[model samples]
Target: MKLLNDDLRNQLKEVFQDMKDDVTIAVFTKSGTCNTCTETISFMEEIETLSDKIHLKKLDIENDAELAKAYDVQMVPSIVLLNKDEAYVGIKFNGIPAGHEINSFIPGILEVSGSGEQLPEGFLKQLETVKKPVNIKVFVTLSCPHCPGAVQKAHKLALENEFINAEMIEAQTFDEISNKFNVSSVPKIVINDQYEFVGNQPLEVFVEEIQKTQA
Candidate 1:
């Protein structure tokens, strides 16, 4: 079954036309362990067909244990974006990029494909002050409409800052992880396991939350 229709495919092709570099979508999924693993692969395959610059590398955690560990993918249906240089930029999608999260996924590929930074000068300056390492885990569900904004913001920060890493944890697929974080709602932003907030926050508010991690 095809996930994208002809019209959507054309739109995506147009969106991807600006890609200056190739992007590799590294996916880790295990058969029988993840209910959405097969479908996620199919969805990525369809997206790959829309752009020449997009490549998909499918890896099963069970079979590719070492690679999975290297990427720190502890759950199934995990995806990480890498640039043409094969460098993992720390932009990760821990769940199936479905629903509103698809908005984040598409732009992630484009941003990773481009050369220059997507962030503004001020944002970069703020990130420079971040001396401590920050690990951000955004808990989301495919049905959540507001989750994409938080995920996109987290990903762009990860892309720009070497000391920060952001991951989108599918609340449903990684129930144990979600439970650990007490993610009862969608778009639960956890920073360094110390500071956390809910909902889609303004960029400044998000930055303030990140700053709180250093306190």
Candidate 2:
């Protein structure tokens, strides 16, 4: 069975029309051990059929170890989006972006395609203060309605600052990591594996939490 229905596919085509540049989606998956790897690839295949600007690259965690390492990918069914120049700008998804997670996934592609909304200048200035390396792991379940907003905010910060990297991790799919972070909520935001918060917070809240890491 196909993941995207006719209505969804048509809606996606309309959305892809707004893509300003090329986006290369590099997917990393490992065989045998990963339960969702096959389904993830099939979903991506359907996505690739939606637009000419969207390119899909299939890779394995084992076969593409060096490349995966360069992107800091440590899990299966991971997706790394590269910009028009094929540069990795630190946007990633660590599980199948299905269900409500599609909201973030689609916007991520548009952002990488150079058609993203611009952040306020004040907020852009605030982002400059982040000098130290920061990793944001947004733990979410596919069915969570509000989880995508949190994921989008995290990825937007990653796009604005080089020192920051963000990823949307499906909670149930990667329960071991979720347990490590003590995630019992729908949208759990963990920063640097040290600081954490829950819910679809405002941009100011995200900035404030990140500032704590610098201090």
Candidate 3:
């Protein structure tokens, strides 16, 4: 049972061709308790086969507790992307990046591989003002067409600022956490677990919400 079909594989190969540097996909999973853990690893295996520059590291949340703690992984079936230097740059996916999330996942790889587009000078300057630690949780449903855009925007902000970290959480898979946050809508962006907005908003909206944390 292959997760990625031939058509998707071919497309990913073409997309991965633009990778300028190596990127490691470190996936954390637990054995029996986690439902999507196995499926997520299988999906990642397919992704690794597409590009020589993309490396995969499979780990268990329990057995690799120390490393998982270092990366601040709090859940199973989580993914952390590392740069060519294997440094954790605060990009993460807490569930399988299937469906529309493939949009965010591929771009995340490219960003870590040093092939991402640069943010505008104005945006860069705005990002520089973020001095406080910020955690961005983007709650998404796989079927939502607009969810990936919000996830990508959150990830792009994380990549530009070391003080910020972002994770895309599949709302259905993490329903309990979603319930805690009262996520009744798709593409719900929660910043620092305090402020929240719903939509595929512009980067300016994201920055404004993040800046609110510094206040």
Candidate 4:
């Protein structure tokens, strides 16, 4: 059987072909036994095979410390997609941007790179003013029932909207983060390392706070 199905590869090709401007896929990876290092690199390389329009660049994190830092790559094997001179569109997939998700991933990249319809209302301004990164630390245990929706919203914002450093830290295991942030309550969202909001709020509220946090 094929590694990636034909449908996905076709969709990927179509999206890149539709882009009216240049697109760069910058990937940073370091050689080692680091978690998901090899798999991430391989997946990225496979991604390149699907598109000529995507200018793929790879750098070793440890060796290219300054470049990695410039891209805000705290973790290994992060992919940032760029369109011409616009600011970077960051991607942090837990495993791979493959399978069913790739169906949406390709178009999302193209749309973000400015090949689609009008900017959704506040999107352009949000893109311009968000110079500083918004750090969103979501604290939740693995088994928390209500946590996934909050986490999904945050992750969706990170993927579709290029404005925040959204991370879902496992509250049960990471005793240090839990204690430091005083996550006495589950689903606590810490924005910009300063503002801590408890429980799940509406998406609009999360978006508003993330915009403020970015500014």
Candidate 5:
């Protein structure tokens, strides 16, 4: 098993610590690659050791093909972070979430999952204009926790405005939207005909963009 160095371990520690509630670290692995797969499994075990709150579940791609398909995990050696009820925190690791990258993934999970619970006050000013129905398309993946928050925010606005049509385009399912919009990131939001907003923006900003679509 590969052990994380002191620096990386500390960083991953900070990430799990920020979790307001329990989190599940889903490790999706394939059996073929001797170097990458072996190292990834060992790395996840080390992460599992770091905390009891951060539970780890390993699944075989070959055996659990449908499981991987459901989450749209097209590649091996991916780490997905989930909240208490298995809500996504949008933490998807491609190669491995080790070293500097480890720090990035965990923090994102907390922030994305946390962002939707409460938005900032000033950010509300951003959502002042919603005059017409705009096809606010949000492209997401199951592994992304932040995507739900973004989707929730969109739904919130959808409830408020008659002219607003908010829809989520699962990137794995809606490959066209992903390719058309160049969706290389998680929780990417696009408004009307041209404007693009990535990440979970505050509700105010979302409202502001809705108004912009009228222009």
Candidate 6:
């Protein structure tokens, strides 16, 4: 059965129409090992059909170790969003972008497709002062409504600052990593693997946390 219904497909066609540059979505999945791998691939496939600018690349994480390592994808059912030049813009989804979290997927595509020059002026100003790299990982569950906002902010930060690498990891799928970070709650955001907080935060607060880590 197809995942996207006719109405949703039409809506997506309009949404993807805003895409000005080519957007490539690279899906990494290990066959037969990850429960959601197959479904994730199917979802991406359907999404590709929505727009001429959207392209999908399928890969097996186990078979393509180098490729996976390049994207820092340590888990299956992961997605790497690239721009027209096939350059990774530090946007990743380390699990199925289902449920409410799916809302973040399209925005990620549009951001990377463009020059990612549409960040808020204030955030852009703040990002320019950062001299060090900041790595942000947001742990989320598929069902979490608040997860998408946190994930979107992280991706936006990555776009605003080249020194930032942001990713969204599915908490349930990556049990070991999630446990290591003590991710018992949804939308748990960790910055530089040093500072972490639970729940969704405002844009100013989130940027402040990044600045705190930089300090």
Task: Pick the lDDT winner.
Answer: 2
Tens digits of lDDT, candidate 1, 12-102: 9998998899999999998785788899999999988888888999998889998787777888889989899978877889879988788
Cα TM-score per model: 0.93, 0.98, 0.98, 0.63, 0.52, 0.94
In candidate 6, the residue pairs with backbone N, CA or C atoms under 3 Å apart (3 or more residues apart, or in different chains) clash, namely none
lDDT (0 to 1) per candidate: 0.87, 0.95, 0.94, 0.63, 0.63, 0.88
**Model 1: runs farther than 4 Å from truth?**
115-117
| Model 1 quality (TM-score) | 0.93
Model 4, runs deviating above 4 Å: 86-95, 99-104, 116-119, 122-133, 136-190, 194-203, 211-215
**Cα RMSDs, all models:** 1.6, 0.7, 0.7, 5.6, 8.4, 1.5
Worst 10 residues of 1 by lDDT: 114-123
Candidate 6 similarity to native, TM-score = 0.94
Candidate 3 positional error at 58, Å = 0.5
Off by over 4 Å in 2: none
List where candidate 5 sits over 4 angstroms from the true fold: 1-3, 7-15, 112-215
Which digits, one per residue and each the tens of the lDDT, describe model 5 over residues 65-157? 876665556566655556677754333444454433433445444543443344455444444455555667666776776676676676545
**Root-mean-square deviation of candidate 3:** 0.7
lDDT of 3 by residue, 89-185 (tens): 9999999999999999999999889899998999999889889999999999999999999998999899999999999999999999999999999
Task: List pairs with backbone clashes in candidate 2.
Answer: none
Q: How much lDDT does candidate 2 score? A: 0.95
**Ten residues in sequence with the least summed lDDT for candidate 5:** 111-120
Error of 6 at 29 (Å): 0.9
Candidate 2 local lDDT, 46-74, one digit each (tens): 99999999999999999999999999999
